[model samples]
Target: MGEEGTAMRMVLCETEESRRTYTLNSFGQTISSYEELCYIISGQYLYFLTEGIPEGMREWIEEELGLVLPAEEETKKQLEHIIGYRNYFTVPEQRMLVQKMRTAYLYSSVRKHKMLGDLYLKHSRYLSAYHAYQKSLSGLMQLKTKEQQEVLYHTGLCLTRMFRFQEAKEFFKRSCRLKENKKCQEAYFIVSYMHGDYQKFLEDGRALSFTEEQLSEIHENISGMEERFSGSEESTALKKIDYHRKKPDDLMTRRLTWSMLERWKNEYRREIV
Candidate 1:
């Protein structure tokens, strides 16, 4: 062949090979080298490189190739798989899988931690849930919305479950201050009462307005606790009214204690000459 013809043929062959690399995923799409490298980092095509490229082209694939699909889809598939069968794995295996799932950059960090918190709560892992909710709050609490309120409330609930009412009160009060919700207020009053701060609940409870439904609910809790306390004769058990079941999430723990504070605030009076 002539030198000019040979040079032209070599150029055509090189172009065809380049086209093959870009079209490897059969997505019928082609992007710049920059975009392809992005695909590699996203891990959509990392495995494809080892299998698709010839040994001689390994360097080129590493430096200039790409993945072809959204990493989120793969992440979802993995999550689904884990949900379907992770119970079969040991605790360490589950932990490793969960940690691996957290590395999915496409997923929101708040959502990741919230889901982790929910999963932990499902297993009655209050401590783990508290930690997860704390992490989520770091990212979400600044929004000062219902989601933030819920996370703060959940954190308080976790602390309350662990018998850390003082710490729980801090979170519950913060949530109430951010947005005056019925739940946060009730939780705050309850936790404050639980921690032996009757003065706060009595002094603050009356000033905080309540919905008719909330008032009715609070009254019911008061009546129920009165009956329970009246029925018991054990003096040492005055503070242990939550013996039957869960406390923080239950209204009973706060019921007996809160009722006493309410009575003191409403019926009692001081006179000055």
Candidate 2:
């Protein structure tokens, strides 16, 4: 039989009880949580389960499938498999698995996009990561506050790395408004300054009720940024342009600015915060 036919035949021959047994016995426990489900099916990308799954995502997947998702096992064999997969799985294979996890499994739209974004961000695919994060934004209200903050923060970080400073600053600002995240707030100020909106940065700080100490820190950061660019042609060129310009207008300045931005992007630790 063909592969598809064989797979279909196997599915046709399987009973719910048998499926349950297959899920439970293979993993050595009932799948009681989304974290366990995500961990096993995705093979080794444990960070996929970093965010708490929405409460509504559980009932449908569990109740309809009748397959008891097993708990995460810490057995030597399982650990070895996880390690091997991380070490050996090709990027294409991992990407394909992410798609399968999105489709074959019943994940909410927000959850699916968040998972996609996290995977892309982890791999340093900033453009794709930004797209995935953008997909999750409309559904942010459905997620908890922490999740919302995470999505926004990641989106901003991706834009920042791409050197879309103005757009990135808006996301960071929104994330800061969601709650008082020091990282988000700092990113907001840094990107605002980078985008040549230093006046608004100071205004925003005051409007947000930033403490004197926080304002001092921002000033320190500004001075540090100025020091970094002091001798660079990019900084000199940028200053000659109108202060309101979001990006460099001259071709040489654009090239120089991109190179400098790359250095700043490299300074960022590759982790979702």
Candidate 3:
């Protein structure tokens, strides 16, 4: 017979007891013949017995049993309430509850990894946070969503702090490609700045096409940092080399020169503070 005919023949042969056995057996639980009918009846009355049936089959089961199943919405709210009480749970208890929720709600692996990553980040465990973020990204790569940006951003930041700059740059660049996320823009800028290619920084800034206010703020912050770092005798020698290389023909270069001097002054002041 054809596939559809075979399926129809199987359906026609299924009695109510047989349907119940099918559902229970699909979950791999063996039911003794003596207890099967009683178990099926109990499952019908409590509505707890349709564990393995797909959602489309649910309507068929309800029609055959002459009873309505509880709406999934109501069941979800009840589960959420039971799991949301933070004060009642210890660390291990909270972890167990999160795992149970993952299974119960059929949360995808990416979501589960992201949740664990966030929890570890909150606790200041950088290595664990990095691992979870990596796992989250691996799973999230299969889906089409903006959530991937968030995972990449966090992973990049963690890797950057861990001094894994090349890997971090990859993530930061990926994040910047995704639409107008201010955090990603800032992260990209910071990573470029750290690489110390001033020309690249200027090029990236142009590519980002920041607003006037953003450009002004970035200029001011760079000036402030240069001033702060340039005050020392050691910094003075470094500034002279940077100045020669940059070739101070423009107003911006001159301002950068003065900012370096100011940083030295601030450093001196901090000794007295």
Best by lDDT: 2
Q: What's the residue-level lDDT of 3 in candidate 3? A: 67
What shift in Å separates residue 101 of candidate 1 from its native position after superposition? Answer: 9.9
- As a whole number from 0 to 100, the lDDT of residue 23 in candidate 1 is 41
Q: Over the stretch 103-126, how does candidate 1's per-residue lDDT look in tens digits? A: 543446685676566655554566
Better of 2 and 3 by TM-score: 2
Which of the two, 1 or 2, has more TM-score?
Answer: 2
Q: What ranking emerges by TM-score with the best candidate at the front?
A: 2, 3, 1
lDDT of 2 by residue, 1-273 (tens): 686656432112121332221233211335543334434545523333333332333333446443322335322323233323332334665466655544534667787688778776766667667878888898889878998999999999888776566788778888998999988887777665554544666776776688757776886767665666566766664546432235445432423243456444553333322
Alpha-carbon runs more than 4 Å astray in model 3: 1-105, 141-144, 206-220, 229-273
> Which candidate should be chosen as best, given TM-score against the real structure?
2
How many residue pairs collide in each prediction? Answer: 0, 4, 4
Q: What is the TM-score of each predicted model, taking all chains together?
A: 0.44, 0.51, 0.44
Candidate 2 Cα misplacement greater than 4 A, ranges: 1-104, 211-213, 232-260, 263-273
TM-score of 3: 0.44
